[model samples]
Target: MVFSWIRKKAADDQEKLKKGDELVIPNQFVCPISLDLMKDPVSLSSGITYDRDSIESWLDGGNFTCPVTNQVLRSFDQIPNHSLRKMIQDWGVANRSYGVDRIPTPKVPVSGIQVSELLFILEDSVESLNGRRCLELVQKVKKWGGESERNRLCVVANGAITVFSAAFDAFARDDSFETNANLLEEMLSNMNWMFPLSQLHSLDHHHTEAAQARLGSRDSLRCLVWLLKCGDLSAKKDSMIALKELVSSDQKHAEALAAIEEASEVLFRLVKDPVCPAITRSSLMVIFHLVSSPSSSTSMAIRSELVKMGLVSLLLELTVDSERSTSEAALGVFDMLCDCEEGKEEAYRNALTFPVLVKKILRVSELATQFSVSAIWKLGRHEKEREKVNIFLAEALQVGIFQKLVLLLQLGCGSVTKEKATELLKTMNPCRPELECVDSVDFKNLKRSF
Candidate 1:
């Protein structure tokens, strides 16, 4: 029975492909420049559809033949868009208003199915839709725009990219890291169609309605999605900064804080975006910076979420870049954090990985010595921490640490008054037995040596 089903499925797939092939391929979908399927189609300022690929091929790669102009398109920029792209843009604008509030609940028309469904289907492969079909459907939905529809399309494209990312990760497990990377690059190239600025006047507009929603509404989910997926590191940082800047006015403080607190959950999700390349890593840094900043008007929800993630150590990691100012600032914050004993404990408890402060100290010995000396001075005399000091010292001594200790003692005593040094020396001397007798001359020489 399974074999028969497989045979039937193969026949159906081939039939569908034949039908797909029979349909007239539009010149609009095909780039005039590369004569390939459009990737990152841009409606240029001149109303022409051109992108990096066209620019490269037509100008630099000597494939300068233009279909419409019948002229050699010397520069990719030369394509005139006086009519073509403007119509698409105008159509998009007109369609956007029609479905602003059309929520795709379970009862909604299947024809009006949104991007989330596409994402869900792809994730489960439930409808047996392949990647090419999935992308085609997304593009189709994008071309037929409503505000809701466009958002849906954007999210679908995002979801498709994620699916590709997952596939790439799986491939990496089979030792195809290079191929996986190439696939990811291709996915990113295709995903450029969902640029936030292209769909709306600004990215903020995309989330404005959702931001206005009551806490935990589906609309809020829209805001969270962009925060997680859309923005680059610099972009995310700027967005957070913009939100924070608004908080000082107090007029929108509560609303902004609420939105950001909701955003924090998304930020947490973003930190785990799997691609830890520089750009994504930088985005994570921006999130940590926001969480660590005292100026941030983040809510309790966000704060608690950060605490759970051991935000302090994460912040420390962000500051590990070669930027001296950043490192010093991070250190200052760390010192302040040390003041909160309970918070420190909580931070350590929740840490994903230990900070390896000792190993780090060894790497940066001068900084480590500064910290260690200060800590030793503070804890060495403390009744509560003395045992810790003894344990630490014993371990150090085992590794021939007496030389370091002697050097430190000399350095520490250099600033001391002679009288104070003498007093310290007296305090440090081991007491002799009262009943023990020695030759007077030998005792005098021993005292001189001491």
Candidate 2:
């Protein structure tokens, strides 16, 4: 009779659970990233627990910091929280009467030994069967690596780069081989995942040079350019990202890439594409990085092409329409471009350039402000046309450039920037005396120091 009564009570509990009853979950069982009961809980070096898949996705996206603590992760390793997993499973079992499902154990992640063996299979054999197997392994590694930082590091540490490079070289060498665009795209994605920007500076010099050589090859360069023009959206983004990494790692690589005529044109097109803001911003950044090294042959080449491609008008437009980072990148590129005669001519000829420059001062971040001021100073110093200079000065006055400059001085800017601003103010003052009293007190104080 007692047993029957217990069974009846259990049935009643299950019935209530099925009737839209709310279940209270313990806080400890929740993953930080998913905010759900962790089916496969893992702990990061930050000592925070998250669902395995959620945390892995976060790390694989090139983020090296702990999401919760915002601290630099000491390691990319994720240790499985077996105790937490078991506890959650136990809770589910205890609540079975309430219709709660028990959590199943997750499969073990790909190991370094397996990755190394597959890499050997790729490198040591040339049979068609081996090639097929190798491609399969590459895809698996990519999938596993994308799920967790540990797998990514393991794949990279196991010489996956060399394996991918070999495959790319083999395919490029033999046009008759069935070239799988998808496979190539996957390889590029994995390469990007392995070598993010943060890891570039730490690479050995030889490694950087080798990468430059491999990527700068005619066949390799052609493939990348083709991918940009014809590949799927994912392929194009990955190609651009890889190109960015290459160019940012060393000046030699930038020069080599700029030497490719098709590359410059493709980058320009990417900049103009409105469909992807992320791609547009990245494209601008690549161009900025390319032209950053002044007095280099590469810089001269890139600047010439930029002018030929109507970069001035585009940059001016982007400055108005883009967000803060994109605006800053545009201004940064403009600053470099204006250093040369051709770039200055293009900028000065544009009616909007000077006005835009004046308005951006004190209107954006300090970096943007600095670039804008420098651009204006460049125009003012280089303008041999007396009438044009007068017109520019008029525009400057009308746009409250003087007030902003005075405010900039009082607020304190870089020494060189302040000197240039002061020089510009002094130059323009002779033409506009009525505006002299605008910030007379602060202006006098700043002038005395100068």
Candidate 3:
């Protein structure tokens, strides 16, 4: 009779839960991520849990809506409060000692296993197998029924961790050249994991220190490539952050610069990475602000580094990047380039650099032409810098930039222009020896005598 009453009460509660009246998820099973029950069927933090594998299978089975929210859950990541991972080891140990049957009832079944990642570490014996033999082994694992397969997968997963750690150690060792690449490549080819196992295997100070030690070194190239190919923005940025820290060390600067160059090369491919957007825009902003400030070590270092990396052209290219911040930064970078005599000389020496500015000025004649005229006037102000200015100015004028400036002048006449541009034109009076093309009539009325 007592058992019958318990059954009746359980049925009533289950019915209540089905209607969404429950405050907490029934502790029938714990979530792997949170190690908690399906409480509130909430997000990753609510300590709620769900049958992720079940949910995944359900989605595969065409059930698209959440059982609780009735809202369409996009993917497992969207399923409310995730299971806390740290609880898993404790739960597993408790279950093993207490016996799974007698373990205190968890909100969910405290299965002593998880599927966060999979690594396939082939033994020397396994590697010796022909392709056909390997395929046969894979088939057997696939066919192995639930519990047995999970156990084998876990063992392999653990072995994979060992192999990955060893491979990273080998990469650190000077003699492991072929072996490191082979092991890393083999691991990548077979494992479902996204990044190198060492990065994902753990987040201890040891790994952090190892990563730091590699910064600005040839080995750093591999890390950069790996991060670019598989890391999230956070990871990529973290690597860059480490690279940034090492830039202060003179001993590491060379390596750091190489790493930055490597990172910059890969940056274009990561435009979609939400974590680290192109430093190009930020760099442009810095260039703009730096140009306005007086000389400083910080500004000098940044300018030197950017110049070394051939980033000036890249910054100029951002004038066309779809982002306004990037375009503005590009404009600012151009402004900075013209601000310094040494930089102006460098730009003048590079003929290719002049065309883009010339083209921009020609297309957006008013804005581009005005900015160029201002820059030219600034350069012209410094008597000592006149030769460099003249060389660049001659190129600009030859490209018909003069014609575009003339158009802007015609438009500005309506706006009562009173500035460097007006002063510059007056100084270079139309009828002068250098202004041979100025016609007689207009030249006489626009004479400097007025």
Candidate 4:
């Protein structure tokens, strides 16, 4: 398993490089202290070169002498050995046949001055009302982010998130989405890779930074909503995707999404007339997070708004044969909505609702099956409508769902799911056709009645 390490180790040591499998490392490439190829080979004042980390660690530990030469160092400065670094890179490339991964170039530290300059230009552009300059600055920062992990951390540390957010607010105030379409797209693309939205939520709402972040979050979300409304087909999809990226997978953005009263309406409009399959899924996700909330009573208002917006039928339409992940997401949200009496009624308004839930079982995934079975049980198990309960059960059986449930139980599932499956089976047991070998079991000698 020792590949050797340079900076990797396997061909080298764990602290230095990836150990190459039995590949002999160049003796010179190996650091004197760590005995591994140096990523940032540096020469000490003692005229010895060691891996930068190894040497620096030694110095930081208050050792005044070189580990190899044992000479007292007059100065602790370690000069970067660029030539040795290049040689290491070349050796790695030449030894690729021996399973040596090419050594990546060492990252240079980002300077605070450099990040400050970038931020200044961005702010200047905002002040001058120069759309062109602002667009260029956005592109430059994006390039920095994409260039290296070091650069991204530096930019983010220097308040690039707050700056880009202010840009969105500025553009929103100007109402220049059409004129600045290209810029908007690039910024959205940039935010996708560089922005850490969790930072927005972690702020203390009373602090100044928190106020700035709140402004950023709301303004950026508003800008995305605006794009969804006025942009072209491609832009609309991009904006929806950006919305998803901003909200992420958590309910952290529940209040943010709900506060933007227009977001739900705009997102629902997209779902009803999706620009693409991707947008439909994104809209569903946003709407799901907006409501299908974590027992937040206030979120119920958002749920009501969506249900009134014809969400029930829209979701049912999306639940059938959709991509696996999207299908599971839609079904999950649909199942959550079923918790409410109004959502339940709205769903029942569609005759295919129960049937669709049946179709998803065992066909999609375990989670989808769980959602489907749970919704069916919640809606059909009790005699909510004593008259129609039999009809619902019949419809479930008509779609071969009884067999699906049996199959689900046979294949095994979670305990809650097992309980629901058992209860539904008992409720619908009398309706299933009898056969000894039908459900992989012998003789239907068991009770014919539950």
For model 4, the stretches where C-alpha displacement exceeds 4 angstroms are 1-80, 83-109, 120-133, 179-184, 199-218, 231-238, 245-252, 259-262, 272-278, 294-314, 340-346, 349-351, 381-384, 406-419, 429-450
Candidate 4 per-residue lDDT over residues 1-450, each given as its tens digit: 222334443233422433546666768889988887778898988888999778867876989998998989988777888767877887788678777787888766556688889889888888777889888888887777777665776676666666666666666665555777788777666655544445644233333243245433766667778888888777777677666755653456566767875877888887787678888787877777777665887578777877888888888888875899889878877887777777878876798797788777777777888989888988884456755667777777777777777767777888999998999889888877742123323123322211
lDDT of 3 by residue, 269-308 (tens): 3432334345434333323443343354544554555555
Please provide, for model 2 over 1-450, each residue's C-alpha lDDT reduced to its tens digit, 9 standing for 90 to 100.
664564445435543444456666666777777887789888989999999888988987999999999999999888998867776776688777666787888766878788888777776643353456656767787788877676777777666665675565555444332366666777788787766634655346555556556665666666776788778789888888877777777667677677766878888888876548777877887888788788897788888888879988889988986789889888988898887778888886888896688767766678998999998888787657667767777777766688778788978789889998999889887766554324233233332222
Question: Per-prediction TM-score, please?
Answer: 0.27, 0.73, 0.34, 0.67
Q: Candidate 2, clashing residue pairs?
A: none
* Local distance difference test, each candidate: 0.39, 0.75, 0.44, 0.72
Q: Give me the runs in candidate 1 sitting further than 4 Å from their true place.
A: 1-259, 295-303, 310-342, 347-355, 361-450
Top-scoring candidate (lDDT): 2
Off by over 4 Å in 2: 1-90, 93-104, 125-134, 169-178, 197-209, 383-386, 434-450
Candidate order by decreasing lDDT:
2, 4, 3, 1
Off by over 4 Å in 3: 1-231, 234-279, 286-292, 316-325, 362-373, 379-382, 409-418, 427-450
The model with the greater TM-score, 1 or 3, is 3
- Backbone clash pairs in model 2 (N, Cα, C under 3 Å; residues 3+ apart or in different chains), count: 0
Q: Residue 92 error for model 3, in Å?
A: 44
The worst-scoring run of ten residues by lDDT in candidate 2 lies at 441-450
Cα-based RMSD of the predictions, in order? 20.8, 8.1, 16.0, 8.5
